[model samples]
Target: MGGGHTGASERASARATERARSTRLNAAEKEKDERQKNSPNATKAIAEGMNVISTTSLKRKRSVMKQFRGKESIFKRPEALPPRFKNKDVPDYHKHPHKWVRYTLGDVSPEDMSDQSNTAAALSFLRELKERKELIDTNNIELEVPPETL
Candidate 1:
């Protein structure tokens, strides 16, 4: 009877130790998981994995401004040439005489005329001046000076 009681006590103690060890292991695993979730490297790896999955289903976006790349000058000259000058047979001089005049008057350089808005504005101002009879010379062949002189 004494031996039987000792045996039962030993078995109970062994089971209690096993239960404690298992709980400790569970706590340690939970802590490890928490640490991994908070680590920068682990977070980055998870993000990269998600990106790969998303990229497979989603198309890459292209910039609308990408078309404008390497075409800075084209934006400056958006307006089409006049109909009469649209013909390939028209001489370059006849195609855009105002550009030449602008160059001669020193109001703008060839490079400056690349900006369509500025060129159009300047040409419209000159035309308006001519219409108002504010120009000293109306001849298209010569550089005209505004009465106000600059």
Candidate 2:
């Protein structure tokens, strides 16, 4: 019991001494600040701590980006198909005033029938290939019997 009391008193004395030292440091700092303010080249100190991180970056994660690099679309920004009216070169052929086509616009025109050559556009290709029939003819009699067994 006697030893405990002495230990308590020692701790109290140590705390008091520490308080006095802290007070002296604070006073000295205040005086230094006043002197700096009085000087022509006074500059305010930037109090940046050790933990001045702008953003939290986990070291475990090599990349800050979300998984799949947002290719999966869940973590990605929203997108949409651009409007078709981007330039003047693209021509709109709808006869109706609306943006969609009419069910039967100019279906049977007598003028179109009269000018058949004007309505047609020719494509360049091999004449022999165009006249040739399909290679596979399931209706052929020769296919029913195999020439030689596998």
Candidate 3:
């Protein structure tokens, strides 16, 4: 839908913009290098800053939250899943063996069992930061709203 043809002006503008961007990136790289020379950890922290929560992003999140002002938002009581697909028993690995049983399934094949397993909404790993922060754990995460809670 976009690029058809560009005249001299458009080509000159594109080259100028590309040169400006390259210049800015090279300057940033030089600054990062200068910081790295002082303490290598600075670079590590800078890198970590991208993945971890940051001030501006956090502020934006907070601003979005303010729209809800005193009301509950985003999160909702997810509807319960239908029973047909809820029939997987915990897997039982009988014994540790040299060759081993790679895996074993019950009467229902995993494919069949999982047809509507996540038909209902998959729970969000809702987390908070800043004011009352919660630890963000990705490796060990609980994605289900336990039946007892329901």
Instruction: Choose 2 or 3, whichever is better by lDDT.
Output: 3
Say which candidate scores most in TM-score. 1
The alpha-carbon lDDT assigned to residue 84 of candidate 1 equals: 65
lDDT (tens digit, per residue) of candidate 2 on 1-150: 899999999999988987876776568567656764564333322234334422222331224233325342323465887776756555465334577755863786766566554445222234444544333443454577677862
Per-residue error for 107 in candidate 3, Å, reads 47
Q: Which pairs of residues collide in model 3? A: none
Q: Give the TM-score of candidate 1.
A: 0.32
- RMSD per model, one decimal: 31.6, 24.9, 32.4
Candidate 1 lDDT tens digits, 12-103: 99889878767765685676678657756566768798453333122211232343357423125568865864455877778788667533
In what order do the candidates fall by lDDT, top score first? 1, 3, 2
Q: Against the true structure, whose lDDT is highest?
A: 1
lDDT by residue (tens digit), candidate 3, 1-150: 245455766998988987876776568567656745465454455778745554654564466446446653335778998676534654344433554555656665676567465443232222223223333343234544465865
- The lDDT for every candidate, in the order shown, is 0.63, 0.53, 0.55
* Best first by TM-score, ranked: 1, 2, 3
Off by over 4 Å in 2: 43-150
